[model samples]
Target: MTTKTIREIALAWKSDKQRYVKQSTYAAYVLILENHLLPSFGDYDSLSEKLVQEFVLQKLENGLSVKTVKDILIVLKMVMKFGVKNEWMNYCEWDIKYPTSETNKDLEVLTIAHHKKILDFIKENFTFRNLGIYISLTTGLRIGEICGLKWSDIDVCNETITVRRTIERIYMVEGDCKHTELVINTPKTKNSCREIPMNKELLAMVKPLKKVVNNEFYVLTNEEKPTEPRTYRNYYHRLMKRLEIPRLKYHGLRHSFATRCIESNCDYKTVSVLLGHANITTTLNLYVHPNMEQKKRCITKMLKSLRK
Candidate 1:
């Protein structure tokens, strides 16, 4: 086998991997490699399942969420495979285990009252940022996707908003240089590049603006330059505070949208597609919680159908 440390192989792997991935994705891999994997295992030439398992537990103890730890492992596995393919290292199969926590957080969403309050407030007050939040409340657009939107993507004629790209600030480590850049890249998955039909409220607001705004300019800024997610998130937080609304992460807007849809009895597959989820199961897992009232009604309906 070629004698290359994991660090060397990882550098080469990410460099080659960049051409095939979006800039944001490559940045994520690099950040995880440098911040976690390389520091821990860079000099090692071989990876054993036990060593990785230990690393997993250490990460968990250090406060990384199970999902985050799993994502890090995924990148680690890919790099190991690359090194193995090139004969630089040997791969041991991983059967890593994660501890199940009873405190798994339920999904957070705006209460129905808060949801109505924000929508009503935004309906009366108009700002580009508010418009973006309005879009999220009415349709389950992720923060990056909403920030990436341009006037051109607003199809008032068809009453749909087509998602094509997303904007974010990404950390990139090149050689010895470490820096961050604001990047605009296509949505994370093919399913994310989708068309969501605008509801009446959204259509009304967008229709007039589409006629006057520069098609190539971003919607949030109404300029060629874009507002990144962090900045927009701050704006959202301040708006929530001003309205005396309890804090919710910007992402909660998307969750609220999805929750409202499911509560309205929108089909699971349709909600999945609109949210750009890779699978309907993800949508179900996040939002298919049946309340006790619904449970009672379901039981009643089921029994009614079998009446003797």
Candidate 2:
């Protein structure tokens, strides 16, 4: 059977998307195809479900996390779908069953006391990163979005922040050596490009910080360049160590903000837009997790309805 190389077809597919899709998205598709997909499937027949299933199972057996495997499958599925639509190939009936992720009961959520302690630590330390921590906790901005923020996107009088871009790091493929570089690009989706109203305290803090920061550069980067995501992670780690607080992923700030918003009785759609999620359902699934207080409130509301 005559078959085209997966690399060639994937490039063709990427080029086709570049014609109509967002540049950042098209770039992501090309990167994932080159770095992850083609490396695994380039030599195989594009129509082989057996190879795809074996690859999925092998990934699971090799202890690749379920989320990672699911993401990979998503990319592969896109390429295959594109192939079918363009008549480059036709292979229906292919399926990838990703195993369930084990429940992590100990997933960290900051209590009010813990949140206060961290905030107080930041206040007393007077570090350059204080505003970042404050804004993230108050606003639920994704790390990339926060890092991408600039003074120009902020409106002091209006008390709002416009989320128009994201800071990302990509490994640049040079002739012989690969090096990572920080880049600023538009937000990941149309839904992610949004505006969020700021609370009073955040407004007071950011207004002054904006004055001191370079007007043309990102808010978080001290050198007027895009902030490396890993550097921010390290800074958070150091902050945790100094405060004697338990370590959580830098992304935990985003989750903590969302969880706090729900507990404080903020609306789901509001929280969804604040977090720049593409859909309210995604926000509900991820951030509307019920704590004991929330569960108790639900029960009370249900029981009260019975009185009628």
Candidate 3:
């Protein structure tokens, strides 16, 4: 077999694995490889562990945040493994480890008051937007999961919704996804494909929304097609601006839901399952686990028990 360049090997791996993964994930892997990995180590057929570490340090020096550089390094490691499997390069130690960032200590989640304000604003200004936001805020569903939702996925009779697909905004060179113009893809992982119970309020909201759809997707386009993430983002942004509320990314809604769940004394494992997180550790790491207030309350309750 003829030896191939790092770029060629990376592209081959991507092409071979494209069918096995969701388009959104493939796009992310392609982006990291194209923009970060190949540019730095394209000349080398195989990289040394020490060399890879040095490259990571240089990226950090070049003003790349540790988080971004960490993601880039992960992509490099994947490509290197691909090269090794293809016999383009010998086995090399995977040395680059993601740096621990303190920023992940606690998520900046929306407060209950803020949640109420946002909900009120949506109800007053855009009643149609209410169902989607309500479901996300209540169930902690990812934006893509909510957007990819179909009527068939929702079981009003059972009060559960099956999360099978996810609608994400992927940058495709050509326009294929008509609803969003961004590539819509499946859920990222098997765990992401979960079944969550529907709250009574969410059920009520969806019932009317489904009536409008005439038994199509719970969320759809004007002609009853699936609603796109881009359109929802635009509407969400407009709603935020009009309401004069703090402009947080639409993703903040999911964070808000997680925060509210924790505050309501919901356990981490349950929240993790609700969020479709791969594990409880991910839920604890990404969402606020136990804030100072919660800690104090726990201590106080324990002391009361001791006194008793």
Best by lDDT: 1
Tens digit of per-residue lDDT, candidate 3, span 193-275: 88899877667656665555555544544235667777888877786777677787888898888888877878889889888
Query: Which lDDT tens digits does candidate 2 get at residues 1-308?
Result: 33566666776777677798755565566666666788898765474777888887887788777777778778788777777666766665776666656664454678788887887666566655666777778777778887888878888878898988887776654335756667777888888898888888667666787767776777776556767677887887887787777888878888888888887889999888888888899988786667797789899999999999
The 0-to-1 C-alpha lDDT of every candidate, in the order given, reads 0.92, 0.76, 0.74
Span of 10 residues, lowest total lDDT, candidate 1: 97-106
Q: Give candidate 2's TM-score.
A: 0.86
Per-residue lDDT tens digits for candidate 1, residues 1-308, read 67799999998898799899888788899899988999999999889998999999999999999989999999999999999999998878989988877366888899999999999999899899899999999889999999999999999888899999998888988889999999888897999999999989888888888888999999999999999999999999999999999989999999999999999999999999999998998898889989999999999999999995
- Sorted by TM-score, highest first, which candidate order results? 1, 2, 3
Say which prediction, candidate 1 or candidate 3, comes out ahead on TM-score. 1
Error of 1 at 215 (Å): 1.9
* lDDT score, candidate 3: 0.74
lDDT of 2 at 271: 86
Q: Decide which is better by lDDT, 1 or 2.
A: 1
Error of 1 at 104 (Å): 2.2
Off by over 4 Å in 3: 1-4, 97-106, 121-126, 173-181, 208-212, 218-222, 297-308
TM-scores for candidates 1 onward, in order: 0.95, 0.86, 0.84
Clashes counted in candidate 2 amount to 0
